[model samples]
Target: MAAGLLLLVCAGAVLYSAQAQDPYDGLPDDYKKGVDLAMEKLTLDPGVRHHFRFLKTLDKSDIESGFGVKYIYHHFYLKPTRCAKGSTVSNAQTCPFRNDRPLIDCAVCYKTAADQIESFPKPYVHCIQKPRLTEDTRTTRTEHCKKMNYNSGAPTLLAVSMPKN
Candidate 1:
């Protein structure tokens, strides 16, 4: 009787924890599962506050095991907001951040209940951080920030494959 009670209590605690982390009920089950899995798997340094914004669906596939969808999203590395020295106000425009310049493409896939996992090929062009302006290097290329000729458009699907389980 004691063992049975303990088991029941453990199961209830697990259920409660699961319910606490469940995403909005209105969201499709696949998306919720994918977000949860991604959140659980992806981790950065404790100091960096990162966010994942779903940009678009790259591709989708129906297989024998389950459905799989490839998604590209912005993984924003956020800096905590703070007022500038000697300034008493804080707003979006006044405050500066490292994320101002441009964004790049990164891809991830929904977790499927299958032996194989499908994902997009590795991106060729990796994102680079804007060069910081020091006293010496300020007069060089950093001056007059010229915009690159590329568009802020989503990447085309060049290749997709399923990794062996």
Candidate 2:
């Protein structure tokens, strides 16, 4: 009877361990390390702390055969540390929309698994707007923000791309 109970306990433990495994465990070691470093920066920034929301995945291995390149892009939004006087915003942890700000795009990329070098390339992060808006720009932004759990008000600001001389 005791042996049966022990077997049951062990089974339960095994199941729990399987469920607790990280979903990204299959990712390359460098990619995982880079993501950790990026997250650390977001949490450690002194002014205007930012948070990332995963946007989409880009698998380029089919096109770029040798390097086994893949990318996951995340966009950063300002974390609300302060509120306007008499503002309805109540959550300090949640980011509120401010018209003056622009969302920053950050790309985490992974190259061939064989490469073991640390800091071969850092995650590419930028606040610069795309040179121009295409027909699909609005649709894409809306979808991305929706995934990020922001309200409808957050993704509506259409950026007007200025012409280069």
Candidate 3:
């Protein structure tokens, strides 16, 4: 009986440590700040609660990564309908060809297209806006930013979210 109790205690300790070591555990200070900022901003939008359940799923790293911010914007702007079961694709932007097709009914085509895009070089791109500075007679002038491109294959905006630290 004592041996069994000892084994149980040991198993519990191992499980506790495993949970503690999860990748998302102990997020950085910067990440927490980002998340707080995002949450504050999101709270002001009336529709945020309805549309963004995954906001809770996010950790501080997600906000810090900028993916969380983009995700909120993407869903707010695009509002892609969720795919049904057995669907090969999740995002409508990724599968423009089959806009009307039900993903569950046409799994093979969806899968093939999704796979192709996945393998396609630079499938996803992000343009970061940069301010342009110009010299004027009186003072320096700053113009509205231009988009700088970032390449990635993930279809969803979440793909680019904060990397695990």
Which one is best on lDDT?
Answer: 2
Could you tally the backbone clashes for each prediction?
0, 0, 1
Instruction: Please provide, for model 1 over 51-127, each residue's C-alpha lDDT reduced to its tens digit, 9 standing for 90 to 100.
Output: 33223333322223213323222122213233332233223224443444332222223223343333322211122
Candidates' lDDT values, in order?
A: 0.33, 0.39, 0.27
Question: Which parts of model 1 are misplaced by more than 4 Å?
Answer: 1-27, 43-48, 66-106, 109-165
- Say which candidate scores most in TM-score: 2
Clashing pairs in 3: 65-162
Candidate 1 vs. true structure, TM-score? 0.26
Least well predicted 10-residue stretch by lDDT in candidate 2: 54-63
Q: List runs of model 3 lying over 4 Å from the truth.
A: 13-25, 50-165
CA lDDT, candidate 3, residue 91:
38
The ten-residue window of minimal lDDT in model 1 covers 141-150
lDDT of 2 at 119: 38
Q: Order of candidates by lDDT, top first?
A: 2, 1, 3
Full ranking by TM-score: 2, 3, 1
Evaluate model 3: give its lDDT. Answer: 0.27
TM-scores of the candidates are 0.26, 0.35, 0.27
The C-alpha RMSD in Å for every predicted model, in order, reads 17.1, 16.4, 21.1
